[model samples]
Target: MDAANLDRLVDTDRVHRSVYTDPAIFELEMERIWGRAWIFVGHESQVAEAGQYFATTIGRQPVMMTRDEAGGLHVLFNRCAHKGARLVGEGAGRADKAIRCCYHGWRFGLDGRLLSIPMADGYDGTRFGKGCPEADVQPLSRAESYRGFVFASLAAEGPGLVAWLGGAASSIDNMVDRAPGGDLEVTGGVLRFEHDSNWKFFVENLNDLMHPMVVHQSSSLTARDVAKAELGPEATMPPALQIIAPFTESYRFFDEMGLHAFEWGHGYSGGKTSIHAKYSDVPEYNAAMEAAYGPERVAEIFAVNRHNTVFYPSATIKGPIQTMRIVKPLAVDRTVIESWTFRLKGAPDELLRRSILYCNLINSSANLVGPDDQEAYRRQQQGLRAEGAEWVAMHRDLGREEDLGEGHLYAKGSSDLAFRNQFRAWKRYMAGVA
Candidate 1:
């Protein structure tokens, strides 16, 4: 696409519907954006031992995260050097000493070096010699960890992980600090769910401050009613109510707090009220955090409430409950969401349970709040196939952005700055500029 056409395709506020519906644009996104960005992998705690490993995908490439004998982490492609069969199956497993491909008995070390192959004498003098670099399993271009979470970049060049993360790094730091030991563990099993819409729909929705109250009205209202019934008419807000309260939170509240957009399309809706205050019913969790972080730091940590922080092309970190939802794109219009709940390494067990419960209630496939939003996204993808409208409206607070250094901007919560910022990064990546 030419510059004029690309400019017309996207605007400052809203993007063209075709950006969401067109298959061609989706292909371009996969090649230019997801191919180069530092996408999130599983947490380090998931594979803590020497032989433990977890299999994941980066862009369209199948990759594995394994812990070597020296207790270091390695992220490598899953294919074997010989015969091209995957060395390990889908899902997490133990590699023991090395990954043995079931197809040809090709053994590879934890770091993906070729260890041995059965019947090796057949090609000793040929190009498939033991010393050939092609015989070793291919490793990713870059692998790095921030705190305990691991991420990998498929391309050899681009911004480093830290530079790419930018503003979103605070979200991860806040999460780790919530734990008494200043660390987190991936304790609960992942909750995988499929959406019938494009992956971008989910990413865009992360910074959508308006939808929670209206789209999730049924659940929010139900929670409100339950809170009232359980505590009586004069009773205050409850923990369960806070769980769904963001939906009913006033637009003014969002507008004042605003959203912050960073480089590479990463953005987050900021200015969240403390959910802990509403949770007088759950004194156990409050006390646990307070005891772990002490009264001052605990208050500070809880006070930095954020709705959802986007990690660009792949994941959303929900800090309040220590929940992370990783996006795996299956197709232009289909995506798989893997939800992982974390435990504060030194916190109480009840706190961990609370995080799991929130995951089930809000992020799970069976959630009452989630289906409504998914239905809207499905219809959006279907409706955008029309020929009438050429542009999507993102005109909210256009000239009102407060510029932060290093290509970051901030605007009111009601502004479309997040969407606008995303398309800017999208254009840069698609044009091979960033």
Candidate 2:
């Protein structure tokens, strides 16, 4: 498509439905957007010990994350240089010192260096034995880690990981800082779910403040009712369930907190509230935070209640419950969500329990709230396949976003500034620029 046509395909207020439904566009996005962007791999804690490895994908390419003998992480393509067989199978496991290919007995070091190939005499006189770098596993163009989360880019050039994270960086910091030891570790196994809708739908849903009350009404109401029955005299106006219930509160509540959108299509919305004060269900957590960070700092940490922070095309970090949902787009209408929960290392057990409960209740594949949202996304994809509608509305707060420095935009929480800022970055990346 031409630049002008692509430009017209997306507007400040609405986007053509083809952006979500077109197979060709999805393929282009996999190359232009996912290839160049710094995509989040598994956490560093997953491969904490030397020789531990986790296999994952960056864009369409299968890659593996391994720890070198020198205590550094390396991300390399999973395919073997000889015979083109995948060196490791499709899961996380230890290479036990060297990665041995099951197909041909070719062995490689933890750092993707070619070590041996069983029959050394076959090519001793040829160019194969002189230690060619080409014979080793190929490495990603860029690999970096922030705090313990690892990310890799398939393309050779782009913004650094920190620069790409932008405003969403604070969400991660807050998540780790809330822990008593100021460190976080991935404890719970990831919950993977398949969605029969475009990945963009999930991305848009992350900062969508309007749908929660309506989409999550059943769960929110149930939570409120349960809380009321359990604590007769403790019910408040904006109950704890309201936070998870999606749309329990009016737009005015979300609007007051303000939203910030950053350069790389990442954004955050929703008001800040204290979970410890709201529920009072985890006193041990509150006590640990207070002991480690003092009462004021603990209060400050819990008070920064963000709903969902989007990390562009890949990840969503929910601060309140310390939940992260990473998106892996498979096709035009297929996406896989890998949900992980973190425990604050050295914190009280109750804190970890709370995180686990939140993950189960809301973020899990079998959650009441997620299925409802998934149904909506499914119907949206079906509807978009029709011939009637051509564009999706993003007109909520058009032209209202204030320009912050370094390509950042900010507005009230209820504004659609996040969507607009996202498209701004999307257009730039899709056009193959910064």
Candidate 3:
């Protein structure tokens, strides 16, 4: 599609339905957006030891993150050099001494260099050999990690990951700082789920603050009712109620939480507070934080309580909860999401346990909360098939976003400002503007 056509599909306050429903546009996004954007791969802790590898995809392109013997980290094309068979299966595994392709005995080192091609004497005259760099498993264009969270981009020439992250970088910083020792690790595995709709639906919904009270009424109301019935008014709230019941928060509560929008379609909601703010603090974890950073610094860190930071077109993270969900697009109408929970080093295990509980309660495929959102996405995918509505409106508080003189814009949490800011960056990417 040309620049003009992509421009027509997006506007300051609304977007054409085709942006979410078109196969051609999805392809363009895979190229122009996901292709160049700094997509999160996996955390470095997942491959802390040598020869361990984490397998993931960048916009349907199979890629692997491997740690070498000397602790060098490389993100490479998962395909083997010889006939292009994928070297590792999905998920994490140790490559052992070297990656040996099953189709042919093509062996490659963890650093992506060709080690040996079996029966090499048979092809002495041909170009296929260990000496050629083309025989090695090729690396991605660029890969960088921030505080152990590895992100790779297919495009080599762009802003460095830090510059590209803009204000959204704070979410990551705060997440790592939450750890008393300033470290985090992916633990308890990941919860994999699928959405039978466009990937954009999930990212946009991350900070589309108006939908939680409405879309999650059934689950949240059920939880709220059960909590009131099961526990005394003076009783301490249980972990389960602390999580699921937050969806019933008043519109005023969410609106006061505020929303932040940054460049490159990256932003987060709830700088001062969030649904997570009311979670009963784990005293052990708080003590550890206070011990590590002292009371004043800990208070300063906790004061910036944010929610649902979107890296955009690929992943969304909840820093307060220490959970990240990765978006993997399978087709125009199919998307897979993986939720990974983290452990804050030097904090008590109860903190990690709570993080896992939040992950499962909200992001698990079989859970009450995620399915509600998934069903809504499914209906949206099914409904947009109609020609009745040509455009999706995003006009709430259209001109009300505040230029905070910081690095990004802010607005009332309930406004559609987040969506408008998102599509503006979307146009820049899909239209090939800088």
Best by TM-score: 3
Regions more than 4 Å wrong, model 3: none
The prediction achieving the highest lDDT against the true structure is: 3
lDDT of 1: 0.81
Residues 369-426, candidate 2, lDDT per residue (tens digit)? 7887898899999999888878888899788888888766778877888777788778
TM-score of 2: 0.93
Write out the backbone clash pairs for model 1: 13-394, 14-393, 14-394, 213-247, 258-413
Tens-place lDDT digits, model 1, residues 1-434: 65666667765666787778778878878887888888898899989898888998987789999998999898999898888888787678898898888988888889787888788899877988476889988889999999988999888998888889997898898888878777889975788889888998888887877676688778787788777788897876554566776566677866766798898889877745533224443466567777776789877887787768898889889786789999998887888988889998767787787787788888898876778888888988787787887667778778899998777788888888887787888878877777
Which residue pairs clash in candidate 2? 212-246, 212-247, 213-246, 213-247, 213-248
Name the candidate, 1 or 2, with the larger TM-score value.
1
| Rank list by TM-score | 3, 1, 2
Model 3: clashing residue pairs?
Answer: none
- How many angstroms is residue 106 displaced in model 1 relative to the true structure, after the best TM-score fit? 0.7
Model 3: per-residue Cα lDDT over 1-434, one tens digit each: 88888889988988999888999998999999889889999999999999999998999899999999899999999998889999999899998779999898788999999988777887688887878888889999999998898999999788899988888898999999999989999996789898999998999898988999999999999888877788856677889889898887989989988999888888999988898998888898899899899999999889887879998878789988899999999888999999999999999989888898998899998888999899999999998999978999999998898998756899999988778888888898887764
**Alpha carbon deviation, residue 378, candidate 2 (Å):** 0.7
Q: Candidate 3 has what TM-score?
A: 0.98
Q: State TM-scores per candidate.
A: 0.94, 0.93, 0.98
